[model samples]
Target: VDKDRDPVLGEFFTTESIETCADSIVRESIQNSVDARSGSRPVDVRFSVGCVTKSETGDLFLGLWEHVSVSDEEAGRLCAENGFRYVTVEDFGTTGLRGDPEDVMGDDGDEENEFYFFVRAEGKSPKTGQRGSWGIGKYTYLDVSMINTIFVLTARGGNGPVGGSGPLAIGMAVLKNHKLEGRAYMPDGYLCEVRPLTDGDDDEDAVLPFGPDSDMPEKISAAFNLQRADEPGLSVVVPYVPDELTYEELVRSVARNYGILIGWGDLEVTVVDETGDVATMDSDSILAVLGSLEDNSEREELIDELNLALWGVGLTPGDRTELGRHPLGKHPSWHTDGLMTEEQAKIIRDELAGGRSLAVRVPVPVTEKPDDVTRWSYLDVFFGSSEKKANKPHFYRQGLRISEIPSDTVSGLHALVIIDDEELAGFFGAAEGVSHVNVSSETKSFKGKYAYGANWLKFIKDAPAQILRLARSSEEDEDAGLAEEYFHIPEVEPEPEKEDEPETDPDDTGDIEDPVIPPIKRRVRPYTIAPLVGGGFSVTVNSEVPEGTVLTIDVAYDMPNGNPLKNWAPQDFRLDYMTVEVEGCNLTERSGNRITVASTGESLFKVSVRGFGSNRDLFVDVSLSEDS
Candidate 1:
């Protein structure tokens, strides 16, 4: 860079420029002054323009030249096309000072110096409902001119200090010239140049009367006039206005910026031409614009009402004193004598004793804005005595019932909890067991249908005692189900059987009538049988049966009738020693035995027994088969 720096690059990087446009700076300054003086007192604003012509001498025509311009017309055309030229000067002087003035003050001291031009034109507030009590708005006029000189004249009305003592007029002149060397910029510079025509001062210091014979220009003099008697306000006269600034465009620009004429009843604005023809505007148009700016303002009001209704119940302990009663007068008494049958009083007492259950309903009004479709719009709470005392209550009971009504059937609606135990404690001191709350809505159905009905009971159950203890515990133990647990029973397995001893040698030969049958060992073993009273006998079967093998048994019951029987069905049967079954058993025996059965292969056989009149018995004899 040091070896081959370009002059163009150096100039581009080093250039400095003003941050804001000249017109914006001027408008902002004037707005600041108007805002300062707009509170509690109205201010009148006036504007004037004059064209300056060069004389033979090199001396600049400082009077009219102060407001004239020779710059390019591009900025002016842009400002006019965008409706900037239609601004209302008076409103800008009143409402445009929303920010701090110190940040707007430039090194030129334009804001402070321009204050002298901001004479309180009226002794009352402007038509616009704006609060600006400082006279800082006059600086905007500087945007239209480069001239160092400005002339200001202000006349006070009967409402001012000199009321009915004749109008008090104050005149001031200000000057700024870039070519004038050695002149330091003055922050609060205002010089009195024009005196009352009747002052009889020297002609150089006195302003000539505004007439055809006067040396004063027609344009400058024509702008000065007293507001009509019916007008009942002040007037300002600005001399040496820039020729380039059109009075119509300047008035319109002022209207656009500050014309939200709120709270101003029957206010009027008029501009008089040199021919004395007047053009007028009313404040109603501006009011309409302001109304459009804030469309949802009514909904907010409804919300406020809902909040008030929900929380407006029960007096606090401190509030009891304010109600002309002792704090403990209405306290709950365990003694039965303190309770009475008075219906209204009983309802109150029961509500307090049983704990309060607050329900809120919100309605969706049909409007341009889309309605919220989520379930969160509804709120329900169930307060228990213990939980209430602990300053905590159940919130958002899941099953709260809500019924929505169409907007045609009701007024607009929204709901909110404005106050509750926590909020009351935060705002006022705690009321040990009392919770005061408020909720409001535009809909009556939420209040009439839900709040006054039994629907709330179905949604929120009374808080259990366990929940109260949990709320009061200082420890972090929230396991409420610690005392309850469940267990499952395991299944049992059957025991294995013991093997039996063989009674005869396997090598003994014997005659066998049935060759397919195996040889059997006969043995006698003592057994105990317990006879059941009806007819069934409990028997223990001892055998060397292998595990996992199915077993079958056959038995014959001998009845008192003494008739031989072949089959009998056991009325009731169960195996105590081992599992067994009978096949093809039926009631066939009549006299001696009620049932009988024969074995085919194994010593185990299916058994059956029967008895008369529900009485039955069975016996089986085990012996080696005669055929073997």
Candidate 2:
């Protein structure tokens, strides 16, 4: 036997950025539905979980029972018992999986083939201007299934399959490679055809679905529990849903991840838990849900952060200033111009100064070169002064919360940046890593695709801080453009040691130096400090940190003429009066231009220190000081 088949995933896993399987699945579902939206309306998605009697759905599990037992004994046992747990997600206001069903040969010219991709493709995508582009989201569905099976029942909106327009139902399963009747069977199987392929002259691959709604058989509908009556949307029904995934987890994730969308009337979700309790989330009820949300995990206060963001978006004034297209300059900064009147600027500044909320419209121009033409994409920036120092910014791209990225935040301020434009969203989406939880330009997708990807990212990162800084200045001094030269954060490049002397001169006053000692591997990983609104900066750290490591933070004002460190003096600024904040760490020592800390871990290690007395684009260095 020639045994040839497409490479299939042998194991299922989730990325670290997404906290849990529940969060991953819910976010992916909403993202995909929004991408397939038929029109400019709120996309409706419902999550339902229930149990069914084995006798009602047992016939659908004939051959699957054996395959399930081979790989997942627990799922097989559940099937053997009377209780059969299931989860179904239905999305209205969507264009379901549309295209040719059997497009295995990738020769379709500019044709949208969500159907073929959903049916067969693995770890690939034909998506642009839409979320879930990396093609990793499809596997997330399979991960929550105990028996590695899910049923796809999509009523495509725009155009049905090339064959005809009708409802489609298919049972998709990806089990561990196994053998049946002394012959090896492939892991992927579809329950679309009328009858199971038996030992005969017929080819197994030819097993497929009926053409139209009239021709569709009862078995296909019965197997997947596809309860669509010519509605335009998609449905994913999973049988034997895992025990760990509960209604409470799913609903909470939905609220945290998409609460903003719900408040904006962009999305609505309904959930029916195993206990038969039903809850619906929409624009009216989302705020109530958010007001009562929990922190979800350790040491973080997400509710306060979320409520403040809602204030920035919902409570801020309707008047907006257009931040027009400005070239990507040498450094990260914002240019605010074209305000209708001076009063507009005054209002914006006064609100921020009073610790109130202010929202502004910001537009950015970008190009994917080899092509030079630029297009405009705008995003919303909301700012509210916080009672306590957050030292972080909340970012959302097309209604998805992008967290854990390195951001230079203004101390004592709550900031929210929302990107809605599809074209620009794609640019930032590529910059995200495999987890899709951060915005960074180091990834292959961003570096390979965008011309100024990294520059644009830094521009957005510094946009909020730059605006807040400029609001305190007059029109003529608004930009402070020249000041940016001194504010540049220089990458560490030690001046080359003048060690080897070509010829020794008696008159030479300077002595030749010894060879440079190699720097040791650090026990404490150091991240750059985020600049605050007024003068100082907040040190950023990842969650994976130990309890007793020392970190050295060195700071100096960048001088255009001489070395920042060598030229530092008491007149420039004093570190003596600095106000320092330490979380999961304790301050041990502070001197001129340097501060040391000993970490005591619980929450993510973070340190915010103010009172620089001067702001000139600081030259800061944070390094692992000791061996712990």
Candidate 3:
């Protein structure tokens, strides 16, 4: 069928810069596979990136012209001449696209098939509780392919109609080749047409791709390296993969983005190149890596609850309900006292209670010390299985990440909350049918109906304060010593006895040895230098200084070889505008080259290296001690 797309389709996917185009392809395709999961089997997805000879690729196109005529001769010629290198994402343990090909429109939903919807329908999905509510995410494949085309091959893993049993379908979806030389003709935009299994297969001009019986044909299975005839699944072939994009990056992105799901036995993703199996990600290995990081015992219990929910472990009714509550143990309205009317906030609080997901707070990375408990971010809050991806907060629908919040919107160790409650899914400016991608750069303003009376921007602005309040409260209870020092006043010491202790010199005491005095250790450079954006490092000065101690901090560029990057050193790294936020302390002075801060009590020291145009923060959790 000829499906004309709006001219705007060209600019739709361009909204987000595709630096990680391969990553998007991997995520989007895998999300579809996972959503089409059948029975209790976890989706097993594989990405195979390899080159193909010109003739080899053209072999599948042998009878393509029989159905749709090509207008762009050069494009047609290039396909046959170069064949093409391709990235194929395939899934096992899924019921392959099923249904009668002729029944394109079905008033009765049962007669409609997955193939019909995917091939003919736009802005629709058949799966419930799935990530792809908007059909737009499917275009990711076409957008990444140089030819703007994709091939689908599938076999019914389950039962089909009498003649449809063991059905296998091969189809191609391609953007229409608009002609420029001939008399003007309206462009069809794009069209999807399946290869014919036989001439008399169906009454429609098109013939559905099906084998004689209930299993995939040997020839098709062998060409694509698909499951044996007995096994059932779907394989998607994306041709003309950009040379700059590599399979390794795709593997890494999957591991980082979906590692949590992998670790919890929810799914398995593997990537292969010409050499061999390039990389594989599973649940156990990811868990091992997380277990190796420095521990946070205070968050361990809550983390355990999250882990349990991920693995589908049996839970009590209370635990299930708790999943819908605020992960940091505070609602967004709690910080809206000054931002909104009490009645408005009360309405927001009541509406938020209808959600069915949790928010997670992940601490910014810091030098490990057992006693200190302070979060580096303003709120230290984010949503997901892990906090490492906080730099680019991704949006997910049903545990599958879809879009990333623009980096410009994420600043200064800020928190990212993934919204996934059934009640709240459609409220965040999601596209027509997709629940994952939110077109709005700013998410504070809710577009859903429940937000009619409430001010969403106010909620977004004030939610951080609420998260910070709860986080700070938890920190205080867990580390009372540090909190007490930062906020409590010290008692004055008693004066020495005036008469009895009249300034006696040590020399007057016979044979008295002078007490040994320790020499002061000066740290000219930071004890730890963390690299941030713009070739600068976040330098922490006097990380272990005592209460009331004055600290001098300098932000500079340093090389990994322990030498100053001389070329970069002369250029000023903007540390003058470094924003300082302290608990139980104050900044006495801040200038271009140096910063001086004094502690009132034991305090948590947080110095941001803004002088260098870097957005990262250095957390120096001070240790407290009373000198005798």
Candidate 4:
């Protein structure tokens, strides 16, 4: 039984690493507390750390450990030697534990009593719309304890008879065989044993202390300050904290798990040490906490911005019709009601109605192109930044992120999917236990289908192309696959140059064959428009050339809409070089990579050549002034 239960219980947490145990504890505890909230007020949860020093308690803690410990003699000895460190989590403004005491031993209990089901019930939860849909989170309390013991005390409301007095229960969870008979024989071999009440019957010995009529052990109350007094809530004390887990780790872990809640003023979490209040996570204190941590500095600014954008200044009522345009370009957006593919739109509308669906296209800046692995690291850091490149669509149910397709799983431009509909929740495999999103069945590949439920591969596969077209670069089109497409150039008609001198008749009669007049010609433009590679304009010259006079032509690239291709270096086209060719003119000297042409004995001429450097073999045409 011990061997069978060891591995089974070990697999309860998402991570086995000791560093993340505090994170698990924080996520599970806060989730339960938030779900157990009673009134309209937000939950106030506090995570504090303290030491049980021998000098302060006078061996009371050591004696208590010796009294409760079972099967592990060395663990008990260690507790006596060093008085033990503890982590106490308290949640105020919640309904305290209330339930029948005897129901713990049986299968069914009062449904309204959250306390009995929370601690005693296994594989069942009584709360609705809770973060913890599955009951696996209840195991975290015991798993985080080094000695596998937890001390629970609750103050119920004034409804039932036990509510007026409050109740306290101790449970030590360790995997060991039940012994029928022993020197310290206990019923069912329970590690936790309750002391009998002063005025109670024999049957009430093992039940949790109840009501103002009964008194709690003075040593227990004094050691932990567990007295509820007038307040009604629950307090959990974990004895024998793991040596490796520190208070700093606890604070950061809590921040990572519930920072969204903290930033939005939904909850308040305070970390208290022996000295005083160490740190607090709230809406106003987010910047200070962000600046204090060195590792997540880049992520801090993004979190602050997102929190404000999402929760603080959210979209106003009746504003859903007006779409928000990104600064870069107008990304393509569609709804099930739109006219794009009636059949598909109807399916989407029926399945995910009342949800705002969007596919945004965000271009990658050329400055920060790290290696492939480092690109995905930002997802882990930022977690839920709006610009985070989720290759496949991410699903958000009720403004809370539930499912996301990893970048590596699907390729192409970055896209986002945030749906506010309750109907679409089950379509994305969100009903898979408490993990929310189901893991792929193939352990080796993350790109496989979901473990269970509808994967919707075809629906997500077609969305990127629709959105990617909105921010498509000027270089390529859909079918040609990265081939440059030329932008239309408005034709330039050169006005006939005003001749300075009037026409003169040939001297003495027309004996020189009427001085065969040369027709003015225009050069055919060689290069494609500059907009092909990036943002810019191209010029075409139609100036006439003078007889026997050399003309020098120069061309250069310019950026009109800032530097979009800063990452690309300018290089000469290897296949096609720029040159000047006249129909009836001599190809004269070429200097500084520019062409110099001279009319040699011919009446009419036109110059033609391949485009200049970085023009990608476009044809440029030039005509001389004399030809006009």
Each candidate: how many clashes?
60, 1, 16, 20
Compared with the true structure, model 3 gives a TM-score of 0.56
Off by over 4 Å in 3: 4-8, 63-77, 80-83, 106-112, 127-129, 161-166, 180-207, 210-220, 228-230, 287-396, 406-421, 425-450, 453-465, 470-628
- By lDDT, the better pick of 1 and 2 is 2
Angstrom error at residue 63, model 2: 1.0
Candidate 4 lDDT over 474-555, as tens digits, reads 2232221122243223245654544455476767675554454446555344322332222222322233335674443333
lDDT against the true structure, per candidate, is 0.27, 0.67, 0.47, 0.45
> What TM-score does structure 1 among the candidates reach?
0.26
* CA error at residue 447 for candidate 2, angstroms: 2.2
lDDT (tens digit, per residue) of candidate 3 on 1-628: 4432324345445555543777678767777777678768668888888777755443555644322345444445554445567788888787766676555453324422676666555544455334554445667877677666666666665655433645454544555544444644343232223454343445546535545452334444455565434456677777777876677667655754565456557788878885665566666565443343346641342233235335333334332211122223223333222333344333333333342233332222111123333222211124223322112333434555444442222223323444444433333333322324434523222233232213332333234334333333222222324323222212233434323334667668578667655554442432233433322233333455567765555433333443232323424443333333333345666554555666554434434332233332222222233332
Root-mean-square deviation of every model: 33.4, 12.5, 15.5, 18.4
- Give the TM-scores of the predictions, in the order they appear: 0.26, 0.69, 0.56, 0.55
Ranking by TM-score: 2, 3, 4, 1
Candidate 3 least-lDDT 10 residues = 360-369
Across 1-628, the per-residue lDDT of candidate 1 in tens digits comes to 0011112222212323222232332234333334344345433343323222232112212332322221223322332221112112322123221211112122222332222223322111121212222122233343333332333322222332212211222333333322323444321223322443343435534322122232232233233333322222223343334333454444443333333221132123444444444444344453333333334643233223223232433334332111111113222211113212243233423453454532222111111112322221222222222211112122211111011111110001122122222222121111110111111232121223222122222112212211121122222222213201110111123444444644766897886445343444433332222332212222222343222223223345544454313444433232221111232222122223222233334333323121212333344432212221
Error of 2 at 149 (Å): 0.6
User: What overall lDDT, based on C-alpha atoms, would model 1 receive against the true structure?
Assistant: 0.27
Regions of candidate 2 where Cα sits further than 4 Å from its true position? 1-14, 72-79, 106-111, 158-161, 194-204, 210-227, 292-318, 321-349, 442-444, 469-608, 611-628
lDDT of 2 by residue, 155-234 (tens): 76654356455577677788777777787877777676644333333543544454455333355456445456677788
Determine the C-alpha RMSD for candidate 1 after optimal superposition of all C-alphas.
Answer: 33.4
Clashes of 1: 60
